[model samples]
Target: MCLQSDLVDADVDPAVIEATRSALHQQLEDAELIHQPDEAHLQTAKERSEQLNFAISSLRRQLDAQTRDVVAPRFDAIADTSPRVASLKASIDAITQLRESWARVHTINADIRSLKSERRRINKDIKEKSEQLKARQSLLGDLSTEFGRLLTSWNLPWVDTAVIDRDTFLPAVNGQPFESLQASGGGITTSVNLACSLTLLKFGLDHADVLVPSLLVIDSPRKAFGNNDSDRQRASEIYSRFRTLADAYGERLQLIIADNDPPPVTSDSFGKVEFDYDNPMVPGVSHPGPDHVSRLEETADE
Candidate 1:
């Protein structure tokens, strides 16, 4: 029932208003997360790996120089003591290579340890965040249940996705978290997918709450897409699924997405409204509001 460019008034339904507020708050939360990416856990692992590499390189260089210094002084002595010199040279070379190789192996082992530590930390952080999300989602669920109870008293379909602790059920692979829907599938990639789906579902559930705002806006959800065509396509598909989820809410949530590039079009579900880049609301742009017009004219005469 809303137009694309319409400024939503403050008189919207409580559920719609709460949805809008949650969506906007969630967007801000996500933005803050991007600005402060949780690299602390990864940094320890990365630094350990780097230090190990540096130590290995430094030891190898030292060993190589020492070997050369040892061999260089024995060049003339080689004729008289050729067999000894040759044997010594072989021993030095073998030991140097072995030591260097061992150093590298040690570094690799250290790297594995660092990675395991990082993974543990990452999992802990993810678990904590998942718990927080569940906490918020539980509040939504209570609201949904209350709404359903009210509807039941009047006899109507619940229409809210009753999802709780769905994220905890997802299987994590490597550092990436994902859910295992199939016998052969489950990884970080899958966890991210599950997260996105849960986000979409949460968006809907929040919309059904009578205390939420009616607006759901995303600045650019696909900004993470790199130059890879397949990745871009995948991003588009994820976005499509998001829109589909929004539509499934069926008048419960009103979505508004703004981006520099046009989002992939679907059949009759979403529409675009382009604003002039010169507009003040679009950022780095000037606006000639009514109050500015006469002031500028008066200044010109002066």
Candidate 2:
């Protein structure tokens, strides 16, 4: 029922609309339509709340005394004697932490034992390998000495010194590579290769341990000779050396020689086979014309 002008003329802190709200409140207060709580009821509620608190305290005291007198001693005795009584959250957490630590220690101990066993096995293998290496080195040293002696005995005119490399086991002549002495054509190559083969054969024959063929085959000792008298003599000397080796080794060594022409051999201890255009090394081969008959006859006479 407030007039619009009255609403406009009202002075308020929050808003001008509060003028109606204040007037309605004053009318309600004057008419006693708004409630006013009784202090007597509030005082009765406070007294009841205090009585409930005291009653609860007395009950809690009785419970604590009963637990301390009866159940506490039994719990303590069980805790002291039986580990299973520790069912608390803190005890379980502590035990779990200790178990994790002990498991880690056990894992580390197992790894250490494995590593120690591996170390011992590795040490034993290394020791055996070292001994084998020493024995091999000694064998190579003897082989080198034997190779040097053979170069001199084989009529190697160009070579002053010869040796077998211990590491690679290749032949070296005059403190250099094998090719350095073979500039005299395939003859030198032939002799050096021949000497190496024979030396290994002799080594195998002498030592029952050095595994090599007791039998050897020579294609041609004088096949590369260029009409030089010294080359012929060298070839003859090679045959002589072969004879001596055969005599010395006896039944332990076998030598098979094949050649179109070889210098005169002083020894006749070996079997001989003659082959020409008529009879070749391989079967079912055609022969040459009659013009080669004289040459083949001359070779047979030689």
Candidate 3:
């Protein structure tokens, strides 16, 4: 029967083949499970650790070689480029600083021009205002006509005074002769002198657009009269006429007239400060008065 089965082995049962295969695998598993390790098996963990160390050492060598051969030379090349980069940065910063300075200069120049323009505008405004003031001042002349007429009628001979230099022309008034003569002369008559002086003073006051610093000093105004009662009365009348004119422009003008002596002047318009050198407060000859003390003392001692 065994010989007949060998001849038909190719036509075997599935369960029988599977059982045979499973039995062989189970024997292999059992044999592998029961086998004792060699010395090489015990050194497996050490061997793996040594292999890892060697790989790490080889990697370190490769890194060293790369650093020395490639990376170090490249680093030196990069270091060589740093100075030029720094110089370029410094140049760019300088250019930026210069540009800022130029911009500041332009701004200051603009401010100066604007200030000049404003100054010109202010000057023009002041000029216009000054012209307006001058125009307003010109209008005051029209009002002086009535004032002059009224002052003349009030016996004010100040307005009737005449001022004649070498070039002045005189016209005859009330059939009186027109007298034109040099300033320094005994040849000039008293009436002509009085008329000329009175007219000149009046015209000057009337035409004055602005005040001039001047003194109206009439020294010995009473000299126009002679040393008699009738002549003195005429002089008083003429002086009264002059005083009326002085009164008219009292606040705006000043008149200082002197005579040989003082009288009780009646005008309430002007102030009078009296001083008589001839009359002394003290009676003694050595001390005549405060003014004559020096002369009188010398004479008294002699």
Candidate 4:
């Protein structure tokens, strides 16, 4: 019992100890069984443990080799290339700045090309407009010459030569505007108006582009002139000039005159329409007495 108690204290079940002792005693009686391990089996176990240790050592060596293979080249590459990387970064930065500068240059070149094209267009337009102005000025020169010739032919009292101003396109007698003749008298004004009208009629007939009709209407050339011998003589000369102009233009021009009395001309070149007290130009109006009728018609008919 004390031994069993001791066995229990040693954490060995007494029943299991007894069973193991009985099995060992039975094994000791067998001829093939020994109390200690066999040398051959111990040697085999030692060989197996040595093989396992060798395999573990080989695996550790392989792991170290793999680590070196994976990590050493990366560390070497990092140590060798720091300067090259910095140089490549600087080159990249330089290329970036050059590209930015080139882009700016390209933009400026494009703007310059656009402005040059616009300048060419403006020059073309200016040339075309200038040509048009030149043509208009030439036409005006021709008209001025024609107008001056008619004024000279009419024998203006004070005017030696007449010309149309290029800038104003108005008649200038002796390098002065025709309006200056208005200060002289109504006789001069009437003469200038008649000459200008005849000149304009001639110009209209000659130029296809002129808008004026080839017709003239004069109310009274001698209305401003008083009843005197000098006025009558001037009126006769004006009528003679009219006859000459009418004969020159012939059927191309139509001249109509409405006057109180006819000029002292015996030429059969012009037709006359006489309106008397008995036969008036307008109806529903009493004519003046037969004594007041114009005797210029009798002279014209004769």
Residues 172-208 of candidate 1: C-alpha lDDT, one tens digit per residue: 3322333332333323233244343335445446555
* Candidate 1, residue 10: lDDT: 65
Residues 1-302, model 4: lDDT tens digits: 75553444668678988999999878777635552447668888999999999999999999989989888888888877888899999999999999999999999999999999999999999999899778778877887787777666655467687777888877777866766866756876787777777777777877777778878899988897767776677777778867876887888888888889866775566888888865766555666777888788897998
Stretches of candidate 2 above 4 Å error? 1-95, 178-185, 226-229, 281-302
Please give the distance, in angstroms, between residue 186's alpha carbon in candidate 3 and its true position after superposition: 7.5
Lowest summed-lDDT stretch of 10 residues in model 4? 30-39
Backbone Cα, N, C clashes tallied per candidate: 23, 0, 10, 0
Tens-digit lDDT track of model 2 for 95-140: 8999999999899999999999999999999999989888878887
Q: Put down candidate 3 lDDT per residue, 35-117, tens digits, no spaces.
A: 53544575896899999999999999999987897888888888997988999999999999999999999999999999999
Question: How high is each candidate's TM-score?
Answer: 0.29, 0.58, 0.32, 0.57
- The parts of candidate 3 lying over 4 Å away from their true place are 1-191, 209-214, 263-265, 278-302
Deviation from native of the Cα of residue 233 in model 4, angstroms = 4.4
Each prediction's RMSD to truth: 61.3, 15.5, 20.5, 9.9
**Candidate 1 overall Cα lDDT vs. reference?**
0.59
Backbone clash total for model 2 is: 0
lDDT (Cα, 0-100) at 292 in candidate 2: 59
